[model samples]
Target chain A: MVNANITNKMRNLRDAYSSALIELGSKNEDVVVLDADLSLSTKTKRFGTVFPDRFFDMGIAEANMMGVAAGLAACGKIVFASTFAVFATGRSYDAIRQSIAYPELNVKIVATHAGISVGGDGASHQMLEDIALMRALPNMTVIAPADATEMEDVVPAIAEHSGPCYVRIGRADAPIIFETHGEFKIGRGLVLRDGSDVAIIATGTMTAEALKAYDLLKKEGIEACIVHMPTIKPIDKKLARKVAGKTGRIITCEEHTIIGGLGDAVSMAIAEKPVPMRRIGVNDVFGESGEARQLMEKYGLTAENMAKVAKEMIKKY
Target chain B: MHDKALIKDLKRKALEIRKWVIESVYRAGSGHPGGSLSIADVMACLYFHEMRHNPKDPKWPDRDRLVLSKGHAAPALYAALALAGYFPVEELKNLRKIGHFLQGHPCMKKVPGVDMSTGSLGHGLSVAVGMALAGKLDGKDYRVFVILGDGEVQEGQIWEAANSASHYKLDNIIAILDRNGLQIDGPTEEIMHVEPIAWRWQAFGWDVIEIDGHDIEEILDTFHEIKMNEKPTIIIANTIKGKGVSFMEGTLSFHGKPPSEEQYKKAMSELEQEERELNG
Candidate 1:
């Protein structure tokens, strides 16, 4: 069911987010978009163009932008606020927690430039712990779509789901994995490939890497089952347990830090019937100035690293 | 000039709101009374006279909205909400209690008529700006009233919101700054000097109005004055901290500390005497 030439077509996920937001604005007059001086980067400017009256540019204030989004949501507007993931999550965390999440407002915080893949900007630009910060808040639905196609579905899905949601996307173009018409739900996981030897659960851009790792492991006669988990807050617990029970060995991959991210979430989800698992992500350290691919390789967020980790886990336990 | 009869009625309502503020905080055993009492007159005027709202239909889409940015004054807001029939007056007694709708801060989800949930300072104005911007987008005439504490303006987000409100030309937002001149630790001037607040608002492109916060007539007149402004307006309502209660007035102790048994009796009797004087 996976695409054969996934890496041939690379598209920035923010493009899909922007187009989907435009579509959402056309369908619902109450849909409003706001950006805090990153409209060009986050791609919320497309929605602003289509629905000029419904769009708000909140200058450079991310905290006030979150509060304004909450206020608009309070007045029955399906609000989508965008900025870089670091500012959207860390800078305005209290505003999101107090105004949006606490009231359970229908505000979708769609942030771009997540993970260490925001290269050349160094650690300040790269957001490594947005998932941890967002998922910890109650009533916040956290999602990180794997590729552009999934992001297209994610935008409208979060718009229809009436509550506070945080959707993180990347700055760089990623491998095109899912079809354009693929379905997306807030808390469901998709099984991209079926195997019995080991289960590799991945999210965001790392899911594409996991697909490549599947072929890498296949060359070594190791059959791998790949799961694409977009939603991290109300995580796919049933899938986590089922894959853990079926495969006996599991590998979790993400572009975020190993701490309090997909790795921790999967660990807690499969803890009832625990198995030997390995987490493939950035170790607890800050990223440096380099190309995105080099940073991913340096941080060990690669298909080769995931395949190696799976092999190590299989041998050790 | 305002109608004497109407002014008297609003004064009575303000006194009633003050009584409820004292009773609710005294019942809860822990709540902010100083700021709550400071804004009683304005809250009474807004909920009863100035705003267009239906207590029965709290979710009425076209109704005016109010965000109590200085949300520690929940007792005051809860009192005004109850008196205006958003909920039963008896519910004010359950403020800050376990499993009660009247939370420690104003929560829009738990309580009806709470337009926005706010406990953290500096959040209310931005939310109100959003609401006002929505009103403009929908071409609705519904106004958003936000009550802010003078101390809360120290938050950077407040300035951000101020910039957005005027930048968008959100004429539908009317912010009432509860200039009680005091904060938790000490006076606002000594703590963080929010003086020359009128000039600050004017510089932010808001049509600034100075009025007596505790005076119902002046509060009504200020609301009327801003009814036709082409820009966002801020009413700098100069007020004594802990107004109406003689011993508590102008003191910083009763800001979050609930009245003792003796203090509670004195406060209630003082409000009762004021009510009697107003009737005469």
Candidate 2:
């Protein structure tokens, strides 16, 4: 049931991450967790409380935390290292690259407070390039879950899948989209709605916005297809081509920079058979301090912007 | 006290390790001879005497782990592994060759007996801490050993790892700081001062043990003394860069440069003379 106070049943993705972590810790004795002094914000403290011995607080040192995660994973422990996305990817990039990705160790880097949606923290705290940074590395599986339910499914999926992985979650509560539990795969896309006019491919919190856009387009007599892509690296090429062929126009939505996020990934995937597309995301610029909702609107990440872009693209192309 | 025969055997092993370091670097045409030669004695001690490892089963769960933090000294590590029977001694000649398993840096996936892959400086100790932490959690007696270059200590991640190792009370970690005094550009003091090195480790809550890294007996005794340590221990091994090789000893030029053909032959002959003396 959707909560009355929240519009369209919003839930914190971090809560889902921690609950899933606790569940994982219960099942596997080798499951270990590390945090870089952001245990409270990342909600890994829940897992820490339940399994004190398995949890490690590395104390404001992200590089050391990543390396420690790699070490634990080296000794056959399924390790998850958590921190804000900015520090997790930027501050500890080399550590993750050398210790985890190069060796192909089983360390899941779950970074919270990703994208401009980390409201009031401004550009410094916002991690708009994490997907770009992680996806560029070899043997890194990058995933940005759409909502709380998807985030819940993603934990076990990444844990089950071997080798290094990067999962990005946002700070603000996101609207819950997926109702029923479904088996989540690493490099697959979910088709929420199907139509003929145009396709809306979205990742992370932007998927919920795409859903809203679908309704808005329907009111304007513009039928739209919605595809939720959680995994960025090893993207679902088959689904991307199918949607590209089905609809001549596509719109990619994300809360990250338009440079190397979902938009670039989709374009690369469908480059063989070109399609007229629009990327609805933060342009190649830094974000300023503002409310998460207001930033989304100002940065053209709202459903209204998506609908407008889709209509314009259809008419122009 | 170690018996005379055992000490003699370890000394012979250390000499053989040094020979392998020179031979590998000579064949590779480019490798870190200075650092590798400096750590040869410690490597011999680790693979031959101290570590509880079975070369036949390198991935043995209970086996002690070693992380070569100053990975440029990979020639020394490969030589030690070869002598310990992890791989064929002939493979040492292929160091850094195209498609060779003996890479410019140590890769755990490619090589046997390598606990953690390290190349970029300041990364290995953190991984060692993790391994030590895992040992503590699993209640395994296996210790995690890391060898850090004095120059490598300039990386801030080393201190971060040192702090966590002490904060977590990981007594199972035994770090050997190869204070060989010379880095690539110049001496570490002139480059980046990591002096009061033992005091630095002590301040970080480690039980610091300073010794001549080349002294096989002192190295063995320090290992023995730390057997009952309740805190993480750092053995600040004062060593000479380019040790054993007459032309290269304590010289900055040989840090990452391979010896010339004549230099290689002369170095081998000197090591052979030492071997003959030791046998006599």
Candidate 3:
């Protein structure tokens, strides 16, 4: 029993991103967009059409694009650099680290096609380690929205933020988790369901999976709460601690490397105030080319896998 | 901004920057003084004479920006910044101290006036190109200057940035090479030759100029010529490594070695006389 009364016409994360761009482009004249040959992919073609002068096609040069974004920020322009997560994080990590993070400039690095869901493009195009790279930087605010609806709010919030920020989104159409009208804030966790048996901490496409697991566990007479954590850097310590207090067992899930990512972040946050936890992510291995759905299932990143992990953890609880 | 007065003032500052390079490194007991002293004159002309910027508002939209691509020569840039009213000149003595804004290499967060933090070599020019391209897109008439060492150009990334600057037609970006001919190792020509340099830049679609990097008059005139030209400029400023210091000038051993207390005194006396003549 899911709530059938709630509208299914809610926007996906990509739609939210385009809608926010149109809104922000209208409000702020200083807001500029740069694409690493992927405006159509990231859905920033709307901004390109509306503000033609402000949009730049850097073209397969992610490092130069990042450096340009930093320069624009330094020169009093609000810059949103859009590209695939692979190039935005992997190809230009050093540039972002030195130019943007080291200087603490206000550049929004908006990355689409994140996680293993990027799929058949294969492991080369897939960016499974972006979260870890961006979060490790000193002045970067790392974000991976749970759904398209949440992406709409996160984009503008990152624009208002006066430091380096990285926002990751997926390419494939997933369930619209948010109602599209709920209030959103960066650096704050959004609690989707309330329970006490076990806690599932999730981000990006996996948030929807976590919700599915919550429903399955409830039917099986297990109470598991779901927390969609979008902003990974300034993590929601209050929400994390509160959930850990109510339910002593926790499971962290993401579509990233097991090391230096959401799992590591949550584990360290709880270590300060001890808690028992298990991590759900790529098991410290590289991804290969495959269907996004198949890859997610193969890597044990599905609702079934989450439910299984929760059941195993409940015995400990 | 008369050429005569500009040259007179910039020459005075250049002498003092060279002196500070020797003195600060001597105080630290170890630091790169040769390259720092080598580029003092070029840095002086760029800051006090060539580059258009406001010390009051460093981020002024129309203000010209400069990036020290060869960050090891930060002593010279830091000295020039102090004289340009970025911060108190007294902060120069606090170099490398923990919690001090001034680090061995320029850190943009820690320092007030550093445009980009450029410790790792072969990185700053791409950033400068980006700034210049931003200016073009914004319709702002700001020029960007980046200074590279003779040896630093040996990096493959430098060529990548150069290719990119030309490909994008980033004419607003001017790259000045301090052809001091010496790097941390012996002469750059001996270690790795980067000569036929002007042809290389010209091939890359730049308006190239060669000047005696030490001659204040030539340096000032070349910059003026560059501002009028629509193409990007590269001034290959030929300079002596440990310029103005008697025993250290043009020598490879002094590239990173600081002088002893006695040598520091000798270098100071020589620079003091040069400063007087420059001011007069």
Candidate 4:
């Protein structure tokens, strides 16, 4: 179980991605970079600086960028398109569906600034429903890496994946959970902690919150397991069934709407194999303009809120 | 390459293709025969003479990419695919039937020659643009070709794609507007005015040209010109709906209607005589 009181957690988001992209670009000539005029924002400018020929500045055309990625994939090129989650998912849903997902093109739609944690930008820029939109499409593998370390693994893991994939990353600096490089496979869940009293299933930025909750529960002498489901679309049914069957009590957390996201993905996976589950998310409400940390705290996306839900689920079960 | 000989050969192929369109539509009890017949000559010129492709290897990486933006006109494309040896010519009868690859719209998974599955109008151009951009990125010399119905250009996405294509200076991409001047609703002008079509594409920074859609030699020559041009090209091929059939020509009623039995006989006779003259 995680310890909430643990301090001095190392945080690195932007630079970690910049290094990963630079490394990937150096090794694979087939790996091309596409930016929607947001090279600096998504930290892909590092790749742009290194490989100018392989990097394309599409000038804010996300739809065309997606189409171009699909085309490149058809011609045996691995394309990584980068932009804010809002524009990548909202502005180019049709292009992703018809061109990328329909043919199952090997295109990685890497969306940064995902969820309400993309604060100060307000509801317009912060995307909470991208997972739902992407999950609805067939052959679209959706993954929201836990932090910088996970993203380092995810970038290469998805590049080798042969079909359409969406990698959602947070804009804010976050904790490094994995001590060393771990095996981060596609369509598989990572078990952070093991227990039988309750199961805390979370994804993306919320994985840290669930881990924090685990420590809080242990203080109360209640044992809880934490499962970080990075790949939301594939849902990691193996782990979902295993954890749910073992604990029989579940609490889902995410920095997104409860309507359709990590919560919805987990619930759908265990719908038939039912459990006493509670979801902690935006609850179908729009986010407000504030600091990223303030928004996370306001929407119950913190350690205390997640712990409260976990405790409640334990009582219910 | 004379106009007379080119028209004679194009007319024969167009009529034969029209006959197949009617027969396939009649068998399926559904198809867009008017647009298919209208675009038959254009399709023939592209497949038989214009495009650099190999029938045996549909996945030839360096082959030119052809996207049917006016995807509803699949009967014409299907006929072209069949004639190009993608499948048996007899398989035309299986169009739109259950468990048949020859559906009302082209599906890449179902058929060998289809580049991309397209039924939703105005989406194919974006795919074609992607292919063109990819060719540039990969340093491949293969060109990208797309055919759009006049009615399909009305979609906002088409304009979006066009602007992007020109912005990228996709000289390898060439679009042919099937100016059959008719859609399922009726005359394109009557339903939605898309006049000054060439000007619109030209304004978007493409190299635009206008030509008779039924002219095979002109179609072939225009494609060559586009290949040599420095910008993306659009050839507005002016054509009549239901081009080869006498009663059906320039009529909207046959846009989706298959010819009746008696009408089919007349169409077959006209095509046979044209074939005889071409051979002679």
Best by DockQ: 1
lDDT of 2 at B150: 98
lDDT over C-alpha atoms for residue A49 of model 1: 83
TM-score of chain A of each: 0.98, 0.97, 0.95, 0.96
Candidate 3 residue-wise lDDT, A1-317, digit = tens: 12211235544577778889989989998898988778888988878998888887776778877877877787778889999999999988888987889888889999988888888888888888999999999989999887667777788888888999999888888777666444568788877888999999998878888988988898999998888888899888888888998889899999998888898888878888867899999998888889888999999999999999999988865
Error of 4 at A149 (Å): 0.7
Distance from true location, Cα of A108 in model 2, Å: 0.8
lDDT of each: 0.91, 0.92, 0.84, 0.83
Better of 1 and 2 by TM-score: 1
- How far out, in Å, is residue A202 in model 2? 0.5
The lDDT-based order of candidates, best leading, equals: 2, 1, 3, 4
Residue A91 C-alpha lDDT in model 1: 98
Worst 10 contiguous positions by lDDT, candidate 4 chain B: B1-10
Put down candidate 1 lDDT per residue, A1-317, tens digits, no spaces: 44423568888898999888888888888889999999999988888887788888999999999999998888889999999999999999999999999999999999999999999999998999999999999999999999888888998889889899999998999988875565578899888888889999999989999999999999999999999999998999999999999999999999998999999999999998899988888888878899999999988999999899889888887
For model 2, how does the per-residue alpha-carbon lDDT over B19-85 read when each residue is reduced to its tens digit? 9999999999998999999998999999999999999999999999999999999999998999899
Tens digits of per-residue lDDT, candidate 1, B12-97, equal 99899999999999999999999999999899899989999999999999999999999999998998899988999999999989
Best candidate, lDDT: 2
Model 1, runs deviating above 4 Å = A1-5
Which is the winner by TM-score between candidate 2 and candidate 4? 2
Give one digit per residue, the lDDT tens place, for model 4 in B1-280. 4467665766666666777887788778887888888889888887877789999999999999888888888998988888889899899999998987787888776888988777778787777877887788778898888999999998777887788888888999888899988888877899999988888898998999899988777877777666545688888999998877788889888887877778778877776776777778
Q: What is the TM-score of chain A in candidate 2?
A: 0.97
What residue runs in model 2 are displaced by over 4 Å at the alpha carbon?
A: A1-7
All candidates' TM-scores?
Answer: 0.98, 0.98, 0.94, 0.93
Off by over 4 Å in 4: A1-14, B2-10, B256-280
